[model samples]
Target: MAQTSSHVDSEDTVEYWLFPNISEDGDQLQELEAFRTRCFTFIQDQSQNYIWHEDSINLKVVTKRTAGDNPPHLYGKTRYGCNVEDEWFIVHLFRSFSVTENDVVIRIVDSDGDFLLVEAADILPRWANPESCINRVFIHVGQVHMISIADRPSSITPLPSGQPSLMDAVHIVRSMPHLTIAPSPIQEPIRQRIEKCVSQIDSSLHRCNVFVPASVAALLQSYPTLVAPAVHAFCQRDASQLQVIRAMRFFPPETRVWTSVTFTKCLYAMLVHRNYQPDHRTGWTLPPNGDPKRTGSELGMKLAVGFELLANEESLHQQGGDYSLEMDSRWNRFLNTLKEKGFFQDFLESSQPYNELLEKAREFYMNSVGVEGPAKKPVILRLMQSVFADIEKFKKEEAHLPADDDDSWLSVDPATLDQILGDKFGLLGVDDDEAKAEILPKLETFLHRKSDYEGLTPSSGRKKSRKLSHLAPPSASRKTSTLSNTSDVSQLSNHIGFDPDSFASAMQGILDFALPEDNWDLESNSSCLSSYSEEEEGGELVDKEMNNYMQTMDQELLSTDVLRTSVDNPTRKESVMSEGCESFSDVENFQPVKIDSAALESLLASYTMQRGGPGPASILLNQLNLPRSQISASKKQTD
Candidate 1:
């Protein structure tokens, strides 16, 4: 079997050994050659892709390849770059083949120069220092392990030459695969399942609701491979998932807590440093791309790189509470380490990303404590309740004290009471004497009624003691008293004497005066018109008879001369009787008077001017009421 010797100065040193499964009975050495050939072929095909999957075994591998001085070596038909392949080939070997924890191959990887080792220079084992651990990093079951030189199995046969044999060292490492720690048998499956889960996560945090299902939780309990990726995904989705994850329990409760804490701390540290080291000691590096749109595979590779650190880290196995104080202590310790290494020179502690990490950590710690910690009763809420409780207690005490009496006005200082009453009653400033005069009586009356109602009759002595100088006694002669002395209207009506004849004549004159009558119901006039219409086909006889009757009336009116009569004329009664007989004689002769049409129109116009719009009866009645001179002038013009 070919093996690479420990070389601190070499950049392309890599070696692999197959450790037989304790459960599987087989000759591992015989299969080692065949396995190497297959691996070489696989690398030849996979060297171009940094990450590739083998669907047959449900396995995935993320790697980094380099082309060094060695040229392509032909394998079958295709050429392979086996010379420059790193220990990551061993990572693929175990994972892609589904190698069990108890039995698997181990690849020794050494960067001989790793910045992580430099930063961790203080805590690294002396044997794992740059010089000694150059080719000692053993990759078993997809985890990086270190086997110290002191722990290496010694060769049974002594070498002939005094110089150490490189072949002997290779044989010792190949024979002692079991010497390094093997991961839990269940961890392989969990890693696959978690990797699959992480692969499905979308890079976008929008509407991303991550729920830690019971199945995932169970897998997480066995192997916390899910922690880093979950945190990365949920960082912008739901921070409460951090608390949910923290509450999960392993056999040692601190395992779950510390795993989450370490993963988060490492992630934050990398982000703050702005660099992601895949395997710092191996000199493999993946700088942060700042591409928030990174695919799940890219994220998984980043996660796997940091996940191995937890398994190798011995101090994280210690017990610790999830209390914020403890969490802050652990976080500060990490920061102090970084500070010592000169990492966070001008970092803003209160920036969003750092604060978000702290908030999540605080939540995890609080959730882990559940009901036992100070978080059960937040200090701010407790303080607020205490303050409100004190206020309520004070109010209850005040309620129990004796209350002031409603009738305790007598105890009040007179001047102060007077001022308060003046302000209360709106009597403090009075400018109008009339308003004051009107208000003083009402105020005095109100005070008198109040004293009576309260059954507290003020004695003359108390009244004399309390001088209300702002008020004046009510006036004795009130304007309202005059109402009682008003004279009776019954006797006054008797003194108003009335002359019966004069009253009758005045009523008669009013009755005789012309007034417009409304004929709203035209049914009577319609009946008369209809009767006249039935008497003749065209109602010609009706019209002729009505015209003759109107002419007879007009002649009688002219003969009477009453329209032109003067109040001084003594022959007014004789002239009326003679005119009546003459008017009848004139009607028998049936002679039509040739009256002036102009004069008649003038008369009608004068009548309309005096009496607005009225019927024939109303016009005749109004004509009689006109003055003697106007009636005479109209009649003379008509004649």
Candidate 2:
């Protein structure tokens, strides 16, 4: 059974039928569910069919984790069934799933009813029409064809409403002969030539960042035979071979002009810059290695593919739809820039390299634009300088305008801002004497102390009036609870009665008892120690202090919940079934509580001061999945 549908707007109305080859056990359906979530975000399902409705399109997809039971739908019997809208999206699916025509029948329809039938209108059977083409056109092995109606399967059940359904189209299309129709005679030789020519590219010269132009993609989709010859010419980097456009007899007459113009501009760009540097971004490579210095198209089919690569980069910057005019503008701008760079002067046309390019351009004009053709032959040299006059003139016209205002707080000292904030917070309720008395002085002192201890003052903003060698007098610096280093050292020395000769002798005697004079590398006449008691006493004192510090740290760690809470509850939830899903549940399930970096830093600094170093802080950061190395790097950047 078949039904005909009239043409709608192809741009707004397009459909795709995906039939995946699943194993007998249907384990692949689970994988398809994952593919659906990762790629087609519109299809959200959990062991069920997902029907997506939109203004311009509709999708009925099966996104199940298992093939438990088949639903009573037109496509229920198949292992997997889904509809795709985007062309590249389908291609990605085919490649990722390793889909072949034999495994599953894939069909596409646009406003024209059948996309492939419209494309292959020149070669379809006479009996084929809108009615007959319905459910007949299918894509197999990367090629499009219309299957015979006689191949329809008998198992297709008719709908109760007496309307046609695509239930058996998959079986019929997949059952058809793999190579039902051979390549057209006209396309055969061109295909072989392209394969031979492109194969000559150096194996080491890897091509990347390649994007097919829309004009080229249309030909690939419909009239693929014509594409190879064009590609062959492009790889050769020769414009004279543009006579290949005449061979595209099956394509409409206007299509030849489109192909020729695209080929001409791209080929000419390459000829203009014969010694152009290789650009990895543009996938630019020199012509096939070991060719002649002044090589021209021997078979007259050479066209450069470089512009196709280069032009897409610009199209990507803008909305990537219909970039033919954009490519032309970019070509003109490229020539203009080269002219301003002094690549072509008055005598350049007479030079050997430019003259060769001019000759090729003339051939391109002759072949693409015949004597009776509507286009007039443009002078190649005249086109080169279509925009730029000279470097100085160009620079003057394109000079950047200065900004109107300076809205910079970059020059404001952070310390000054901190002080101002403290004063503002203190004066928040100054009208109430009780509140002012209670908050004002305490708030100011607390803020000042916090800022000072955290080293929030920028080194650049700090006054550098004092010399590094000159220590500040006691009154000049802020007082602390502990005695100054100078005072501590002076008092300790005075209390111990530190006589230089006696102190040195005692240290030498202790060292001799522990380390021995014979083991020393020095040649001085140092005697052995009287005893090892002095060295043993010092070692015992250090051990005793270390044990006390360890006991204090153990008591604190046991009392605090920092490490215990982290070990008990993790931020990111882990589960056996968890994957990289961006579903609502996955997104809402976990959200990190934001902590102020400054506060965290201040707290960590206090912990380090109490514990004697950054050892505990590093361990804490590790538990939080924030490595000390990363934190240190961030801290350095902030500083």
Best by lDDT: 2
Question: Can you list the residue pairs that collide in candidate 2?
Answer: 233-302, 233-303, 234-303, 238-302, 241-300, 241-301
The alpha-carbon lDDT assigned to residue 193 of candidate 2 equals 35
How much does candidate 1 score in TM-score? Answer: 0.19
What are the runs in model 1 whose C-alpha is more than 4 Å off?
1-33, 37-98, 101-104, 110-122, 141-143, 149-179, 182-639
By summed lDDT, the worst window of 10 consecutive residues in model 2 runs over 72-81
Clashes of 2: 6
Q: Which pairs of residues have clashing backbones in candidate 1?
A: none
Q: After superposition, how far is residue 222 of candidate 2 from its true place, in Å?
A: 34
CA lDDT, every model vs. true structure = 0.32, 0.33
Which parts of model 2 are misplaced by more than 4 Å?
Answer: 1-11, 23-31, 34-60, 63-102, 150-165, 179-639
TM-scores for the candidates: 0.19, 0.22
Q: Write the per-residue lDDT of candidate 2 for residues 1-639, one digit (tens) a residue.
A: 021233434444445555554444665544443332222222111101111111111223343322223211112101011112233233233323323224545555656576444433333333356866676555555444344332112212121112224444545444543323223421233234334433432221211111233233332223222322344234544444233232322221221111112221222333333443332443222336455311222111122243232222233433534323225543354345444544344546555445433323332223221222112122222322322223343234323422212213224576666445445323132223332222222222223332455333311112212221122223222211111121122233344443543465466556654522132211111111212223688765655555455445545654764434332324322321132122123433433322333444454454334332346554443323222233333433334
